[model samples]
Target: MCEACSSATRGFLAAGDCEGLTSLVEEVEFTSHWSYEDDSNNDSTNASNDSVRNRSMVETRVPRYWSWHQQSGEGSFVPSPDLNGWMLTIDAQNLSVGYHYRLCLDVDGVGTMQGYGYTGVKAFVSPVKATDVDLPLPRARDAELQLSCPLGPSGASAFLATSCDTTLPATTRVTSLGEVRTASVPVLSAGSASACSVMLDTAHLPGGRHFTLCVGVAGSGASLGMIGLPALGDALVKVYVTPISAFTSPRGHGVVLLGQNEKLFITCSRCTGSSEVFISSGACFVGLASANSSFKSTPTFASLLLGSSSQWEAVLDTSAMPAGQAYRLCVDLDGHIDSTLGPGDSGQFVRISGVLAVSATGLAASRVTVPLQCSGCSTSTAAYLSSSCSVGPLDVISGPLRDAPVSMALDGMGGFTVTPGISGLELFRHYDLCVDLDGIGTVSESFFSGHSVFLSGLLQVLGFSTVFKAPAQPISLSCSGCIDTSKAYLGLSCGGAGGFAAALGATAKAAPTTVIRTSGTSELLSVDAALLDAGKHYVLCWQQYEQCGPGMV
Candidate 1:
């Protein structure tokens, strides 16, 4: 008795490399593995005669194809009764077929009959072994990687791992091994897709390492993995057939999208009156005169018919599109009808751009452009367009805009202003007196002597507390350092002669401050004021410094 198969033949191999598998030998002979041609070299004439006679003799000994002969003693070599033409057969009565014969052709063989009987009889079936066909595993990839196992009729589960070997952490998905795994389970709705609990985190596996997958019966309690066909492969691309009349919608009333960019434009001439179209995925929508167009009721917006020719041009911004991917184009019409309407005519239809090929993934435009129109199938009861508005490119204002005054100053100190008048001058002098300054320009304490002075309380200024409330921080002055150095410095000064002086001195002591004196001109400035502490305020005054040259400065 011979055990035809053992566990050794079932051992797995790393994907892509099948090194030790056996090959099938079809013809069998128990003779010297040599030819008579060798002896011919020694004697030409003799060898030729010998060869012809030997060939004739060999042909006579060999029976016609499929002929049978007796074994050594009483046993016979009869063809198999179950099949014919090179059929492996046996003839016996009450003879128990003890062991199975191992036949190796392309791969290791295992099927061996046990029970044997007379001709035209059945034999005991042998234990069937899983045939290990040489199936090349897919090459591992950096992105999505899939390993498949053919489970024949039985469904299987396969573990997807980062490593070629199955030892590491992996994900398992059930698949029919040999053929398509047709599932009668509940349909996988929009959001419910079975996912493998095992995660293939590339970070865990060493880069460039190879992995092997196990193909085992699902729920078989085996460590090996099962297999299934890809969900996104050929089977998934089934042509979903639907009757054209199923979409009975009105013509010209719908939304249109162009290009992969999915830029949706208005179909109605009255842009403002046109319903705000929210284009999504590959759907288009228009108006329909049905009472229930929403999937639920008998009448639905599905009745709207957006015709083929009527399309709103969609100018997609390709810069915003992804590269090299397929996009679906769909349309839908959300019905928002006025109560005054009855069963109507102005029908809306979802419009889709003609079938187009997006060469590149990112933002793309269509070669053939289309004009757009909408449904005006005005019904007596339905509210039709009384008036409409058209829109164009928006108008925008430019140039410098005036802003509220932020900070004002007269000289190098913190100060307040005096309106242009005699009393204003007196009031200014009074404030100056309180500040203990001589006059607006002098910075002496005498001019502020008679003014009503108040400490104003200590307040949090920029970064420090001060007796007087800090005036608004100085506005910044825009200046290009590359321009006339003198003019840029002048541009930075926030009014006071001392302020300009300090700025010019700090910027370039050698570059004189003669040019930036815009005393009379009402100038706007943005100051950094890093020179002043946050909350601190100082005594102030204003003085006429350098006057602008005659007409302008």
Candidate 2:
């Protein structure tokens, strides 16, 4: 093997220089060497001696010269004069593998520099090598163990061995030579050629025990001196059991209103050990719907385990209990009664009431009757009328007339009716009538209607002149057939010619006068005399839309 002087040695060489020719001679002689051999055969050896003697005579006569020298065969030397350093190269073909070598350099006046000595300087051919091992931490249900091993030049095979002892047999050994084992570990080239891995099925190993793993190689076992697998004392070989961590269904807590044949779902964290789930209502675990003398008979319900061990379902029939009543529910693990569910109310039952139909009598000139029908309501509950169902003051209908007293009445059954007077009510106006059996807090629905104005009798002018002089002041006119005093008005046309043409044409030419409204069957119209002309005959008429009373002139 070849070697070069380290930087520290080169620094010493560069700082120290030969002073004179004598120093140069010393340095050159220090780097040179000679070899001699003895010949045993006499006849041919004498001939070689004669040739050697002749060569010696020529060498002695010539002047001797000295310079930096290098050994022949398997090595070379290159000098860097500027750097005062030299490098040596050696052909390693003839060297044996796994052996260390040391090189020494002698410089005149600089002492000797050596490599691979007791100072930890050395190089070896074909050093033993291996890849990192990836052993898995044993688990309860794990079915297989996978790992990787080093591949060698000649290829390799691998195996997995298990032992119950804390420490397995020695992974490495020597033939009195402390070199590592030259075993070739198997390579899994189908996946990665450089990195070989192996998978071992561990189903045969018993659970809940400690085990050690030993990895070994074949093919190049003798070349690699020793093997050391990773520590396996911490490996656990037991079966895995999933634990029940928490509950998921029925939420944290609240009331669950279960109707007839309605299913209640219960969920929990997955667990494989136990498959049974149990449900109970009273103190002890009683059959679903078991009869109790103190309380009402509990309804028999059906339960089923759904999907995996995480969920269960129970359905309620509710046929034994009356509607509108409340019940409490409780739950627990199948056999673990001490482990109660989360805090707060576990469950409850609530019956809902509904309105079937709501009707009202036709809104008439005098009154309106609202009739309501509902389910799950008592005879004492009366219906109320309001614009909205929001809890607040209600606009309830009262007494006989539009301005009468306010009251409500219900029949013995769920039906009820309220007749409120419409005397003061505005005709042809829509009203939203909302009825609640138990007021806004309970059940209710809304109805709508518009008050209709009826012309019961013919429109008649009670007091008017067929012909009259224009009055100095407005005249008081009256009518008897108007629907109501508030909705009725009167008009007159005067200061025109006589005859039906004059009467019909006069109305078109004159603007009608409005009359003050009053609360009675008859309305009095006051005509403005200033709107009339003197010495003119006029025709008077009573009109509610196109229905006009017999024209008066």
Candidate 3:
């Protein structure tokens, strides 16, 4: 065998990192070499080579043998002749039984067992026990069976239980099998099995259920027996019966399951993630149409819940409402939910409930609008303003007239008329038609029951009279005399002694009086009463400047 080429030699030769030479074998006293030769004396070899032509070869009795092991001190010997480098046992042998971490093989000086050089080392991993085996049985029935004993390394017996099913418990037994001690299963009944599986009766499990097989081997001849898991596996058996009904909410839908005869209402204020619009009074329900089926229905109000993925649900009791007949289902995804219908849109009123069924064969459809009313007013007006014309005839003809007052007269003799009447003669008298002097002045008037007039330039509407065919001009009226009923003027007028005066119009002046003061701290001040008239409408305003605090009140 080659000195460094032999696997055994190389395995031991690489005691250190380098393979050229090393002294670790001498230090550790570990052998790292081996050799072999043809042994013709062996009965089996002699018989096989008996047909050799030469009688000397057939009768050869010379026994050739070679040996290789770590050599310390002494003289070095050359490799045996007629031998080629071959891997030989160095780290381990069948006779030797012990644990070793790192073992390398070197055959002569050429072969290597590991990456470096052959160490002639083969790994023998220890065996561990797997899960126990068990026979399947119905949850409600009594079960008993025999199991094989467990084993460990060195073929020793071990103690174990039949607790293969996670949902159940187990018991074990010990017995003696001739010279070797063995284990047997203890007697088990239905009561023991019931404790393992709660709520499971024999009636429920018509077929046997699956179970992991297990075994025990305590107090046996061997400490434990080795467990050899087979490649093939057996199919499991099961037995089942009718089951009870159950309820569960679908994931991520914000839903809940309810029992029979039960009712639920969901009020989600604003739509959340993935939701677009959120109206107040958003509500939803489920299974409202059918008693047995589950579902969510719409609320009666007009309020709607808006969102991209926003959703809600209502659970119902199975006992309360069953399947079949159509029920109420009203959904307002965008508008306010109201309780009733009225004359106009109230915004507050929305339909919360409506009929819903699988078939649309026979069903009535109706619609309703809610009533509207101002908060502080005594009488509410539901009338719709159809048409209004308030623009100077010149302005209407000259410009687009988009900014013209709707109720103001557009002609020089006309004023603003809010109500557009059917007749032309009636519209001219009631509304003073005139053109505005400039675009600065604003004239507002409303005729809910009369005709409208047009205007163009700067002018004023003096006043109207019940009997006169024409109104009085500013020069024809007397400011100092008693009030006259025969005529009314719509023009500019004087206020005091030398103030400017013009044609009298709808605007009225206050009666003049001298300035004076009252004696008491709290006195009633008379507002100009002349500014108000019997048949005309006006805006009256007053302000109170308090010099003191609550004490004054």
Candidate 4:
């Protein structure tokens, strides 16, 4: 079997390098960064100025071509642009009607991944994706890792081998009696996935994070890993063996939005012995000036719909859960168990960033926030946020904004603050207090969010505690190394010595930067047409609107 697969391929290198665990191979998809090639590489199918538009200008972008088989016996794929990546089919020379073959992305990371190891945590029948959290092994309990071959026939005895030392095939080591695990398990049927779970003797296994699990099927002798697809590669999985037992799923990017119901599938392998399963929630975060106390919901018992015991699924009906409030997920096994999910972190929770309402009433723009949850969305769905009031440039106040003593002064200690004499400050926008101090002349120094003269910093900052709710918003000054250096507010039109004028000069871009990478004034070169007022003809050019100044012109 090894010779047949070896003859079909050579030098199959894996992609990506995990930071610490160097022995194991990552099982996720290699990222597919896609962009259309220029005219030199165009296949006549390309269109001129082809622009793909979704609902809004935000939240959507083009996708890459999917690669179903970068390494195959003889494969071909039709370009699947709509799917965000290319889609392809593998035409293996050795694939029979009733045999299990390991399919993979070929390499790892973004470098050159080609295949997926026929591996997943042996918890669900569908082989759920592995979590970044290390599979915690209690001092006494044994954890299970799966070895599978979906393209293989029945009666193929499978063996599992885990190792701390890399560079050697566990299948080869097992064949040579090199202390690799060799076990045989039953096969379900033809064309059915032949899977076996080899228990790890925790005592014999080195008690640390970095380890790799290798598997093989015994046919005419044993083939390391899966057959056919990955060519001659072994089914290797990276394991982070830890003394700290933990809940694995729902660990990363727990985005919870408002007006959405979330169902979480909770599983804990070390949690099998407990008779009853319970789920609990708690406020997971608190920042400065937060009044809310640490909150933990009473653990509510849940009836398990499925699972042996440890691997039970607890459905979280978070319909009534507070939006925009991050909450930690807990197993609630204090009285029932001897082991606790020690310092179980946000891997057990979700973050909400949904804004319920944003308004600019009078001189204050108020914001209401909730969760930014996703329903039926995978963790790969990315999110972007820019906190500000106007999409255009700061509405430079023209009029003497207010005729009162809204004086801004360099206090004796160089402290920057906004007191409650709030006059006609813009509502619901973020404003950087542009200032001119001694050495640094006219730089954006102090920044305050949530309703200030520059319409307060931001309406409501995402992932922050309830904003410092007050009439005069507190402006957190970030003037580094500044100590009362003749400060003057730039163009704010307050009774303070600050005033906005033409000296507030040319930024890289003009008012309302329209370009994405708005690095300079050239971004607004988007204008195309100009007509002559005399006969409404296309104007050739325009002369300078003003005369030169002094000798610098």
Candidate 5:
């Protein structure tokens, strides 16, 4: 038997945050303190051993005999190593979590029951789970991600590991740097053991790869420990690393031309964040390639949309940009995402070099440098077109795509060259090229004959890409004092010696063509538009003659 520590020491937490403890005790009224050597011989004053009864706490004694719910049961009352009080453990006891518990102690003395202490005050004991983890694990790359975690007293250091397969190892012990990916610096060690949040550096993580989160203390190996996640953890626990920035459309390199008021639609992937596009002076062959390279003081921000977790798209209105001048265009990520952590190494985006050739005087030799751009289209969709080559409204009667939808594939830059020669535009033809993108939108434009309409468009105005013949281009030549030759005309050819394609246009050389001119006053020739192949350089040739009879009279 043991003495009573206090007559009224109830209402105290019997055990704080107990673990692996189970018990079921009967609820009885607090009346008197009595101890018995035998239930039949209960004389409260003549109790057990006087030596042990004098001590309030008997460390050597293990309290085992007790009744639960007025029934016989076995349990133990021992000092707790983690808390400042005693903990209760029992066998053949039924208890559930989240339920408050109260335990009373009765000991076996002299081979019989002995009532020790009847605490007048009430007490409580709580069963708590050990450690836990939280979720909605965010996707990150080369940036700082704020997170919350429950890290009690023994503070821990957060660690990150990457995996392409998205499969975490069965065991949590990760020793190698390759396995752990990267880790260092303590986490949530700011104070005593507590439930707190922490920050994770999402750097040095490969893009498009899966990652695992972990925490450890005083250990070389970082163990994977996200244990408190909710059900359906498959979607919540899987974390991925995104690229800093990359060009998804217009490819990574090339030349893309744009007309005035036409937009250059760009799509990019940046794990860090968004960015603004700038039009620099002239096209830089080495954009962002050279650190010394500078950009225009002013920048033209494009209309951007975070299309998905992997890609974002933008469209720039070139109306503010000066026409006829080539400008370096590039997509940047550092401009948007916070890069406090080192961005590892690379994050190259889109860069193009090309001329903005707009002509009110018309292309020399009737050849226009056409720059075509397309957006909101899949990589396989295309466009069908037929034109008379005039930079005007689409001629539905002349367009072949009127009956059914057609598709075409544009170059990486969504550009097409318009010239008269091979890989060039046709002489003069009007076209209505149309594309029905992913069934979500349409992207199509027309550039038939004399009216050269090259579309550098986005979304509903754009589609896939393809190479087609150049639309027709009309030309008119003039001279104040010149000779009118009935055999004069216009022709095209690849860049070479004398190897020319046939002439295409209505001219003096054309059969039964009418020529309007006044000898020695003015000479004017109007050539009709004609279709030519796409993506070629053609040399223009003009045929004209004059007969100077013996006029020196």
Candidate 6:
């Protein structure tokens, strides 16, 4: 027998396996190192030096090996050789089911190798349980699902399934799958780990309906669990309407007037597909027709179908409505009332014939002019200025003359101007100036209603005198007929045959004359009539020295 065969047979006999002992000897061959690296120098010493370093490193390192065994009682096997010659062992009792693994070897002298046989075993994979799930409202148009499961040797994946039919199972409509990922760190003491989350875009789905959601692994589908969400309403779309203004009657131009029937033009933002548009005026509702529609009716009031454009025009009749009554315009969409677009008096009719503004004019004895502005007032409307706001026996100031009739001149643009000449008016005195619209209505609601405006600071002249006497006794006298009291003096004269003569000198007359001063251009004086002849015709006079025209007696 060959020397290698004899040695193998003897080893088998010693191990008590001599009955089936078979021996064979073959020389092992290895590829030359020159094929892996350049050895053009043919230097054996360099090769020997490299081998020595590698061998020393292999000897100092601790060896590790992977052992795989079959749990079906097929015996254990170390499929890979250890670089440091370490021994490997496998116990079948610790192996699990439904898992397969292979061994890898890193030999010191040889290259890396893989085991030819695979070990199949069973592993305990905790059932996938959905810890929590969150889905957005139907209007939000998005879906999200979260789940958790036991950390298995191979981590699990999750997916989201949605169905429009709430009665059907969600798994039937698998819309999206969770991304694959490795086993994550344990989140709880129960060894439960969070799986990959699932997300779905629901923007394309119709709103206002119920939907079902299911979370599960890729292979398990929705078997893990399922949830239901209530029906959601559609998202709100903002709506806005432009302001409406009255239109001119014959000219058909836009204007603002009170209690006048005129066409109204309106513009708005189109937010929905509804062709029927309704406009609300306070508690009243009116159907509006689009300007482009062919529907035609009486010019008093009519409606048009709104076309593709956002503009709408209609005729409003205010013959039956009172002046100063405000109107509100509101839009209704699919039974949804949108009041935000309509503010107070957005479509109010023109109740005022014209607006009035009063201002003072002139220097001393001042005068005032009132400007009445009207956009689309009737030609028959009459405007005038009045002292009182009452109706009967109106105290109206018509012209620049004080006694002239109160009247306003129309500027042909629904406006009027009235400049009243107020003479003999007391300075610094307030007089109410009001504008009355006779045919149309009172412009009292305007800002210029009966405003107390007048000019002041004018010079005035006045004179007065009083006499007091006791029968058969001395008579007392008082006089006020001077502009400057400092220059004023009381003069006395006794009746004489030729004429009355000065009874006292000017200096002596000042003693009896008590000058009383005032704020105006007049002065007062008091003197005792006893200073003159009693029971005699006497003349008393108040006079300013240089500025006096004549002394009054």
The candidate, 2 or 4, that scores higher on TM-score is 4
TM-score of each: 0.14, 0.19, 0.13, 0.23, 0.22, 0.20
Off by over 4 Å in 2: 1-289, 292-313, 332-376, 382-553
Candidate with the larger TM-score of 4 and 6: 4
Ranking by TM-score: 4, 5, 6, 2, 1, 3
lDDT of 1 by residue, 385-478 (tens): 0011011111121112211111122322322321111111211011111111112222111111111111111111122222222233332222
1 or 5, greater by TM-score? 5
- Put down candidate 6 lDDT per residue, 38-92, tens digits, no spaces: 4336567766666544332212333232222223212222333423323234332
Error of 6 at 38 (Å): 99
Ranking by lDDT: 2, 5, 6, 4, 3, 1
Tell how far residue 248 is off in model 4, in angstroms. Answer: 14
Candidate 2 C-alpha lDDT tens digits along 472-550: 2233434333443222212343222122333345443234445454545544454544445556654454344333322
Lowest summed lDDT across 10 adjacent residues in model 3 is found at 544-553
lDDT of each: 0.22, 0.32, 0.23, 0.28, 0.32, 0.30
Q: Give the CA lDDT, 0 to 100, for residue 479 in model 6.
A: 23
lDDT of 3 at 513: 24
Higher lDDT: candidate 3 or 6?
6
* Clash count, predicted structure 4: 49
Better of 1 and 4 by lDDT: 4
Q: Per-residue CA lDDT of candidate 5, range 1-553, in tens?
A: 1243222221111221222223434432234444433332444555565434443532333443322332113354555554456544443124222112334454331223344332433221112112222222233432443343332413344445543112232223343364236543344433444434445555445443445554433322222111111110011223334343444333112223332333344443443333444445433212332333333313334455545554444454343332222344433344423333211212222222222332211222223233344333344333333333222222332232233233333446645332222122231122233322232232222322112232110111012222134222322334322234432233232111111122332222222123456444333334332344345433223322221110000
